[model samples]
Target: MEIATYILVPFILFALTGLKVMNEYERGVRFRLGNYSGVVNPGLRYIIPVIDTMQKVDLRVKAVDVPSQDAMTKDNVSVNVNAVLYYKISDAKNAIIEVEDFKFAVSQLAQTTMRDIVGETTLDRLLSERESVSLRIKELVDKASDPWGIKVNSVELKDILLPSDMKRVIAKEAEAEREKRAVIIKAEGETIASVNLSKAAKTLAGNKGALHLRTLQTLNDIASDQNNTIVLALPLEILESFRGKNK
Candidate 1:
């Protein structure tokens, strides 16, 4: 009975101390007595009870929110902007060894990088240059975090918060631009119409019968408008011939 008790007690202790379970999306980093140790694969793992410590790291993509930062543009405009970062741990060993807190370091780095980018661009560029801005930010973040085994997949500017007065000014400026374009388009159409009319007039003047036909067409168009009042202008020679024929 005493032998049985000893065996059962040690079995229970081992089971409680050495057993570790890792999910499919997690990997465990094992260290022994302050020395570099290998990574533990996903599944059950056994460690020497107190001599080894394990860190469970998630392998899946992580989404981090970059808080709003007030940044001054190159044009001396102040804007508040916030962004999102999609990242993942690429090298588990380096991630464990290089940084004490990789996540916080990355977050801080992103903010500073964003500010730097904003400082280099004007407000118009910052607002209009989305693809370029995102690409630059992602490249910078990835380079900065490479030492920490962090891979920045993509960076996106989620929101740009501008002042109400700035919004109003921008809107007005946009409206003016649209109005200018409209005026230019209308003028172009009028020029085209004038050229077309001049060409038609020249063609009709070459044909003697075209003027009469065109005049008849104009009268027909006016009659089709369902109006009763009509005014006719006849040449003096034609009116005189008509009076002599009637007499």
Candidate 2:
């Protein structure tokens, strides 16, 4: 009876000690004596105390904010770029066996990819086509980290900082472009106005009495505003008739 009690108590203690609980979003990679065993999903898991070991990996997506890195664009313009990376472990077994630290590996890969891509892109493209740039970074990092069981969901460029002088130059360039467009538009408007005026003058001269009638209309519009004193002049055609009579 004493032997039975001693063995049963130790067995119960061993079973309890080997038990490990995992959350719903967690997975366990089990290794038996330095050998890869299998991945255990959420809920109650068990492993031998001395011979078996487990590493927990969170399956939930994690957001890692990459610090600003100094990079030079293809145009030889130096800029600082920073981004946010979203990733999660896809394979717990591979994540444990393949990489020393999956999270750190992902972050370092993201930073390296960002710098390389930024170096390849021009300043204008990096600023204007940020979405594409970020997507390319995500793709490169995802591909590179695939062996580590890391799944990169997305990468977003948080900011692109330029030098003060560069900012001023860009502002001046934009202002000049705006002014150029405005001048072109104004010139087009003036051209149209002059063309219409020429057509109207030709029409008035073609008709015999159109000029006199238009002159009277102008005087009428002026007279509508009683605040102004209008100086009325006789029509040139009327003066020409008087000269013809005298001749």
Angstrom error of the Cα, residue 192, model 2: value is 3.3
Once fitted onto the true fold, the runs of candidate 2 whose alpha carbons sit more than 4 angstroms away are 1-3, 196-217, 226-228, 233-247
lDDT of 1 by residue, 1-247 (tens): 9999999998888768888988989888899987769898888889877788889889899999988999998998889988999999998888999999999989999999999998888899889997688789889999999999999999999898888999999999999999999999999999999999999999897875887789888878888897787768585459769999999
- Prediction-by-prediction clash tally: 0, 0
**Candidate 1 residue pairs that clash:** none
Which residues of candidate 1, in runs, are more than 4 Å off? 1-4, 226-229, 233-247
lDDT string for model 2 (1-247, tens) is 9999999999899878989999999999888998988888888888999899998999999999998999999999999999999999898888988889888888888898999999999999999999999999999999999898889999999999999999999999999999999999999999999999999999998886888789888888888886858585887878889999999
TM-score of each: 0.88, 0.83
TM for candidate 2 is: 0.83
lDDT of 2: 0.92
The whole-model lDDT of each prediction reads 0.90, 0.92
